[model samples]
Target chain A: MKRPFQNLVYLYILAGLSLTIFLVHCGLKALTVTVPAQAQVDERVTFVMHSGAEPRIEEPGTYTTQLLAGIMVPKSWNAREQAVLTYTSPKGNGTLRMIPDSEIEPVSGVSWHQAAKNMFGIGPNLVDDFEWIIYRSTQSYTFSNNEDIDFNVQVACNVGSENMLVRLGFYVGSSIENLRPEDDQYKKFTFSDVFEVSGGEGDVQDFVNPQLGTIQPVRSLDNDIITLVFNGGVMNTVLDGLNEVYLRAQAFDSDGQLIAEVMEQNDKTKMGSIGGRQFRIDIWPRGFFAIEKGKQIARLEYFFTNADGTKTVGYGNTEEPFRYTFRCE
Target chain B: MKIKQLLLFAFVAFGYLFHASCEDEMANVVTDEPVKNITGSWKVVQLTRNGEDLSQRLNLTDFRIDFKEDGSYILANELPFVLVGSGAYTLNDPQYPFSVLMTADGESEQIAVKLQYPVVNGKRQLSLSFSLGCAGNTYQYNFEREN
Candidate 1:
């Protein structure tokens, strides 16, 4: 009779254990799992946790230790104990969801601070609001050589703004490099507000370089003109060591039509200040002839007479002619 | 004792749920191809200015340029004056829209010009524009491939 009773007891215990296991598994699975809540614009969310009970909110990854604030559980909590959390958002009341961090795509049209915090889980420490605005408003281009010697030119401009900055970066094959203004002789490589317009016609800005000669952009009112001033000062410098020079300008319209031609003549009397290096020539798209705003000025062709005047110094006649496109506002 | 065992089971189940929700981040990369060589002869087919056609102004016949592989070029102008000039040319960028630096023979000065190589009517052509620093003039040249 006692052996039968013991067998019955053992059976009862086994049944109880199985029931407990099933209940525990079901209870854990039933633990509230919610979808990620989307906060409305300018909304604030508050999280509340019960005392002495902590919830472990691990980052959504196999090996990420990044713990977000307010949701992370403390080690002091009981091993088997789960914390009770209540979260309230000004936008709406919703259950917090457990989704992988990677699934959180940044929403557009939000403040930079909010975007940074939501996407990176860090504050806006790398770039501030002002800096971010400037970055968004600017356009930049970088040019470099692939050779062993490092030479680079970086230009940045805020479009529609009045200024542009150009920087030259040079590095030898070795490691050390420094950008020193003193080492820059020609100053041609550096320019500030190079594209700024003085607003009216006849306003001129001169670019001086010992190696490159003087170039001036002079604005004229008649045809919305911007004349490239290349006079004896520039010619003498360009043809310093040579004798006899032939100079010609070929002007074209926006339709690629040749409209005007100016050739340097041998008759010094007709040429303004014959033997004087000073010369003024109009670029394309002037006043009434100007292309609509934002359209590039007509292209210009330059031909220089060789020292012998027997031939012209430029891209060969059969080869492509050299061209320039300048635009005025 | 029974409660302890249930807690252990619950913990294990919760751990599994957390691990199943993760995914690996994906990466995407893009690349660009470099430009081709522009070493060849080009003939001037049209010359224009300010919405006007001035092809008759300069003799377009026998007007051609020969660019050698060595960066040396010869311009043959067969008009008013039959002149042939030779010079060194340097291309700043090895790309479609690039600047050309031409130095006349025996002259150190370089005249910089921008050019674009485009295909027109199934023929390779070079389109260029420049100003002679004149008061109100610009020139456009369209050159077709000769060789």
Candidate 2:
């Protein structure tokens, strides 16, 4: 027993010393991300991810490198084309460009953009509609063995036409090793507090918190097969703990009329059990609804129901259905 | 003697004609035609509904279409298939297929869909795109040759 006690005591001391050494050699000093508290649709906003990072290169020789930056934004923003990144530092400054999708990064044998996504996934966001938009400084910097530099990047991006609360995530790293943190908080990832894009149209999509159900491939056409999911176990609802669930969905035309739509509960509209009391239905919107010529599904309002068409549950366990609007950016 | 000479001449002429006819017969050249053989049972390994993957979320392992060597198909599904029940199928172009035409039962109208025969992971994949209900929605069903 005494030998075990001595071993534990040695372990505690070793852990403390290791942490101290890692902190002393920390490359990232600080990271601060600033996004507009509120902005308008179609408005171009300046989002900032500021970081003070010194080179972690020990036994450094003169080497060339570029700073890697990534931002997780709503897919609706179409940031790949509409956003521009630029940097500022005591070393130098220049325009930053997006690393094209699937461009191989030599170190990881994967695309640099994909490597970042693999490293930091969605960054505490609840929905999968967000994408990691990454960029690299077009200008490479040469630092000598004795030199050190710190910098930050600013992004000018266009907000989408949807009014929603978006939780934006920002990340910073280097091309040296596209992997983990040698030290805790290597300015690796951080998220901005609820950035708002107001004065737009449609429902407010909350990205900061967990949603009961969200559609994948948020932008879709009537000719697409849309899968609707319900997490009855996520929160308390009228339809909770029910083994059998059905979907009652109404498809509206562009004129908002219930054309080519059916709001019914039947075996065809029955939700399949995905375990955990979660339910899903994969249906082609065109085939599911009886639409005439020139008629199409513009949006959908849906609810989860128990057998006999009773105990229906809607958004937030309320009476109103969860709605989704379909469009491409 | 004249009658004998005439008979001999007729016999010689007949013999010469038979020889010439034999020489006129050319050998029938037989060349095998190239066949694009995707004949086998194919399983739906991946089903994408409007660009959304439903492979993991749904149990689509049982879904399949068997293309027999006799140019007939048995659809083992009620899936939003364009053609229903057993059908006689044909490729629009044998060498370079652009579409797959399916004639169900005795239906006069044939159902056709764009087809892409691509080799993925060294396995032949049959990819078909069609709209069963409304023409707007497109579902891409990728089926792989079953072992």
Candidate 3:
């Protein structure tokens, strides 16, 4: 009878051992098998220029493999945790978002602050209201090799009144300063990060003429007249024909697609003509032409020659080239 | 005999539970669901200057617009030129109409819209306009709802 009891105990011990092994294997398999749930990333790329002394430019930076592609955050992550990365380009600055183990989708039409919180952080004040647009990548690329990629991101934000008036200046340590025509340092820099914007034309003339000082558009058509009217008081030297002037036009479709380009010259000989030769102008399609109907036009950039013979460019008001569609028969 | 069997079953169940809980602790990364409102390809159908149709072509994508509902908006082009603008905006109620009041590139100028017509399914046909320097223009636009 005692021997039978011992046999029973032995059988129980064996069964328990086998069960432990089986369960351990199952747990290990579960841990090894990674199943990424349904995930989506919406990437919006904005080319931004820093105003003030720094005149900083921001562009999209490199990403790590550990950083997931989409902007969605997992439900398990704390609202404060964020994977924030910043990249600086010659033209501007770029910010990339990394969300760890999250399942929450980013909110639409909200400010950048709200979006950043949802993507990787539960923490407040992590996002700057000055920056908007959350962007994502489509084709997956391996970050293992540290490859630099320029992901084409797009989205339309209001071209506020401030930027509406074309800013005429140069970048100084990643910041923009109100350019003075006579300033020698101002003549060295050029325009960059040309993008399409959706906003009311701010101060088209607010952009100072590189040749003449304090410029404004006089009786102009963004679609028809590409004029850069310079006031007499700003810098009378260009009007006196003492200096040469050059105008460069870069055009893009409404969706921010580059369309046509023209660079024309209006030197000292041509300066004294228009009282001020206000339209240090550049014309496309020769004589006169209208945009083909049903076609969408975007950006228009202008660059001018400074007194020292160097150049300074200004961008025109960016608008949708889509023709008016409201006509009652 | 019955007690013994019960004990054996209990032991097995406890082992399974312990293992399963441990698995949850690993770096289980997963993909998130697609966003609802701002997803998919969006075509630029309207361009306005102070509310007037400047009559130009401006076709671009959400990628082109530099708009990600999650962050600030930046619009820039290829080279030799770039401008940075930023501001806040929200989709106003009468949710069906889908109105948005936005300040562009940090400018004080305000833009407001009220959809009037339909462009695509789940999208609203709207009239949008902006104000600056006592001079403002209005235009009609077609915006689709995100699928």
Candidate 4:
């Protein structure tokens, strides 16, 4: 049994302890809570047109890059055109050539070793039987299926030497597809890139051009894609409700150095609503970065829903990629 | 003494809560309903465009419409010119001075009107104005209240 005064004193001590614990708890919370700082978003870039033949990056500016064509420059040894190239690295001198089109006959009656000498300026340890076929088409052409962009690059180096490589650079151009007559927003320009390789590697075939923009929906309404039509181009996928979609656009230079053309992400409507409902998401382009000039970008709208949830539905208008005149000032 | 004090506190709290709820309910906004007298059919007297009268006067001897609050509307000119069509109508926004959105035959049209102020002896009136255009010419039609 404690006296009233003692009870009061005990209460005061307990309150003080509680106050100290509360302060410490608040300090811990303050340390753990993180408020995001202000971030700068990149401006959305649309494709633009400019001069100069070589693949050049204009000043800090935005431009649309499309795949124009897939070309195969076959191996030749007649001295008029040389596909085989020789390099003298620190390890030793080696030879290599742009893959030969198997359709074309080997230099008449020349053995594989002799042909290697004429093509690469040195003999190859092994001659791959695979042939190279370069694919080529302008933006006006549409692909119906996923076809292979094939190539065969042969390389060789000093006997028993490890640092030898065959550096084959493939530069391709794919045109932007589907541009409507009404919208003049972007001038289509076909871009290029250099893709390289090295060593005593055998035939490299079916090398897909990576520098083209591909239409892939982050999410489709009803799992059904909305078929968007680019006036002169092809329709890949569609936009739908509650989706975080991604699309890829790529471009390469003359040396086969792949210049990636990606959605800068700053210009996107991060979250869009239609038919009256809010959904959580971020939308971006994804798939093969393939595009061409005069092609319209169309989205195929579709959707998906929970097995027991309400029916997932979608509806809205789509903005197709249009061609406009762009001049670099 | 404790029970009496507890009852007194509970009674006072209940009274305050009831008054607060009543005050909250009264804060809602109410819009004006359509005039009861303006529910009949009216004929088109004239059609004008850009201060000039047009040749095709609306042949409305056969035109008729009946609007009722029981979710019903009838528009029967059942001919090639005007097929009988009826549907429900909803006021999209009642804050506007005088506007109506009508849906019939699965088609919706927005209508803007001018209303006469001060309901005289429980009777109100309004006017229908139509902007007409034909063959590069435009005009306005003013239809007075029939009743």
Candidate 5:
């Protein structure tokens, strides 16, 4: 019995030893490890895997390079009639005009390749057929979606006093299915019918809508854009001499909810030009209107305020006030 | 009985030897060497944003970062603006994946960056990778030590 007990002790010790070995092995594996120092830095390390082959770097005189260069040229340089180039190819010959800026027009039968070569000096084989197709498709989509949907109004203001403020307001009338002025129902409208506006300069102040009661503020009526041009130039001394200028516009939708508000102001110092002379103010509305296919009437209001609390105001009914009625088809 | 006692002794001895060997191997793997100090001007050779090459975005062909020994850095470029950021840097791990931390002067935020020092065309290059607070987007900048 003593001998058997000794053997049993040996077995128990073996099992315990095996268990300890296994535990130690696992513990070592779980411990955090740092990479060997010698293999740390590599010269050809790749951090990002691109989806495709690397893009070729742009080269000088390439088609794309020349195209971008042409676009960056001043528009006034291309506007001159002397800038036109005449090109002749095996297929045809035509006058390549760089008018209208950034665009080259080839006369009747001249191939686009010949025009591009003559105008931008880009070789005909530079642009592949696939690229040409994509370019043409994009141009088609832009021209097709953009039709005669723009309504423009230009106003000229002559500020007689140096300490005067000018204000312009636009109002949009009720929506009609057809924008044509010949519609008999249009004549029945009056100034009271105007409730919304397309575009203007400042935050919409409170306005009493004839049909909707006193709306707190008005918003843009549609996506239509309105711009004010002073003296057909961006800067004029007459506008710069003013002590202060306030430009504001507000538009409301059919549901009488304010949609857009634009406000701009310039003090005397800010109005002065680079040469210390006064500059005219130009209002350029940069956004489009969201008007549906329909007819609408718009009203314009102008005001001039003197530094001494005196004012000059003009309404849509005033002689030659800036206003228009148009249709969107 | 004597055999049984000898076997037990052998097992215990082997275990001690194995444990000692593991400890020594780990010590070699993580050396206690001092971190390298990198203080000098560096020029950006390549810049990639979200895996796209944007090295030409800034006209900085002559741009360089001057790192003074006093822990201040000056970013000088041919562009219109010059930026100066002061911070301390560290290259704690000299091996494969290195850790670097830079803190701008007057800013508590620390920018954590990973870098690798690789030799290419017989010239040493410093490549750093970090995120610009974009979701899952990272920028990798490769620079050449100017001085």
Candidate 6:
């Protein structure tokens, strides 16, 4: 009788151990995106995304879902047309297409493009005009119960016409699950090392490092409103630790003649602090300068100054003012 | 004779009620709402691009749009706008306008602009949203009645 009772207890212990193994670890276990440290403009750069995930069957049933990937690049790249994505896993292998701006993310309730933007905005980059081009798998995989899967994706995109250093970003998020799954563990993201694209257009735009001044809509007419950002914390400077800062700028006409200038550190020219050491000001050239009807503004030469105008910061942290050209293609 | 008189009375009452209802239907109009009043100079109180606010960075205080009582508008210190200088303007459904149609001084074609009129902080506000150079970049300008 003792032998039989001992056997029954042993059987119960074995069953518990099997259930524990079946449960396993659930969700995105690990992920990494690999890309070359440097590439030339208009050159095709390959980015390899290797990811592992284990699905936990909360209930007894089969489910169908597709994977999705979001890749961030400069808006000038026209990535929607230039980038191509392909994936291979135990589930299947197929090419991915740019999920139209209309395709909605199941969990986020927003377009995949927008969802990616909301998830990571530039990812520590200083430049403002960046786009997250989202791609969706062409095939769906079926799964039931505890299962382990691995995916390897190949992404190729041509660099845009710009000489710059920027960190690329990648995000793998919420699959097209036909059933319930953990929302948090399904998302993983990473930013690559400073990517250098040389022999491109214009001057070298540094996004990895902070700067004294930056402007948006790199190309715009005088008729459009423009934003100028003064980064005081870029490095040691006169206005580095000051709590208050102001902008003193001169607007020039097409012929390089100074048309209007505002050097007052009053309420109108005071810069609004955007947390940290960054400040911003928006100016409509037509209104700010009050230019005549037929004349057009050529550019703006400006500098940052502290209250009472004792300390000033200019181009290359020198006494020379920073110059920004106003043009539109 | 009494029975005949009672039948005549019933018929007369029914005819009188029917005629009264017809008259009511013909005179049922009671228009109450007046045309939306937007005759004032406005300036850009807020500006946005692709839904990102840039009010602090752009100097929009001098930009002005004057909507005169003569159904004409004049633009001063203009930004990217559909019609420039002065133009003849008209409202769609004057009583409850959802848009304003403007024909520039030289052009005959009409450009319809979506208008949002709201009163906040006890002051009337005019909001206009448009895409000037690229359809991808949208600019919204909100203007409050300039004191």
Index of the highest-TM-score prediction: 6
Q: Write the per-residue lDDT of candidate 2 for residues B14-126, one digit (tens) a residue.
A: 99998887666644434455656778999998877645577785567767899998999988763456765688889998877868888887778987889999999998899
Q: What is the C-alpha lDDT of each candidate?
A: 0.38, 0.75, 0.33, 0.29, 0.33, 0.79
Best candidate, lDDT: 6
Worst 10 residues of 1 chain A by lDDT: A128-137
DockQ for every model, please. Answer: 0.02, 0.07, 0.03, 0.01, 0.01, 0.17
Please identify which of the two predictions, 1 or 4, would achieve the higher TM-score against the true structure: 1
Share of native C-alpha contacts between chains A and B (below 8 angstroms) recovered by candidate 4: 0.00
Give lDDT tens digits, candidate 6, residues A286-324.
Answer: 767777877888889999999998889999899999988
Ranking by TM-score: 6, 2, 1, 5, 3, 4
Ranking by lDDT: 6, 2, 1, 5, 3, 4
Docking class of 2: incorrect
lDDT of 5 by residue, A1-329 (tens): 48899999999997797655432321101111111111111111111100101112222211110000011111111213222223222223333223233443334133332332233321222111110100110011111111212111111112111111112121111111112233222111111111222133432221221111111001122222222322212232223355443333343444545454442333421221223322222221212222232422242223322233233212221222222221121
A32-147, model 4: which lDDT tens digit per residue? 11112211121111111121112222233222333221112213111213223332222233333333344332333343323222333311211121112222221122222222
The per-prediction CA RMSD against the true structure, in angstroms, equals 27.8, 18.7, 24.4, 31.7, 32.4, 12.7
Q: TM-score per model for chain B alone?
A: 0.68, 0.73, 0.37, 0.41, 0.61, 0.75
Q: Flag regions of model 5 displaced more than 4 Å.
A: A1-329, B1-34, B56-58, B77-84, B92-97
Q: Give the DockQ-based CAPRI class for model 1.
A: incorrect
Residues A90-117 of candidate 3 have per-residue lDDT tens digits of 3344444432224233323334333333
Tens digit per residue, CA lDDT, model 1, A1-329: 47878999999997797655432321101011121122222222222221110112122211111111122111112111332222222222222222233432233234432332223231211111111100010121111221111112111111221221111111111001111233221111111222222233332222222111111232222233333332434333434444344445566767988765556445320212224454333322332232343444465666554434445434323223434444433
TM-score of 4: 0.19
Question: Which structure is stronger by DockQ: 2 or 5?
Answer: 2
A-chain TM-score per prediction?
0.26, 0.77, 0.24, 0.15, 0.20, 0.82
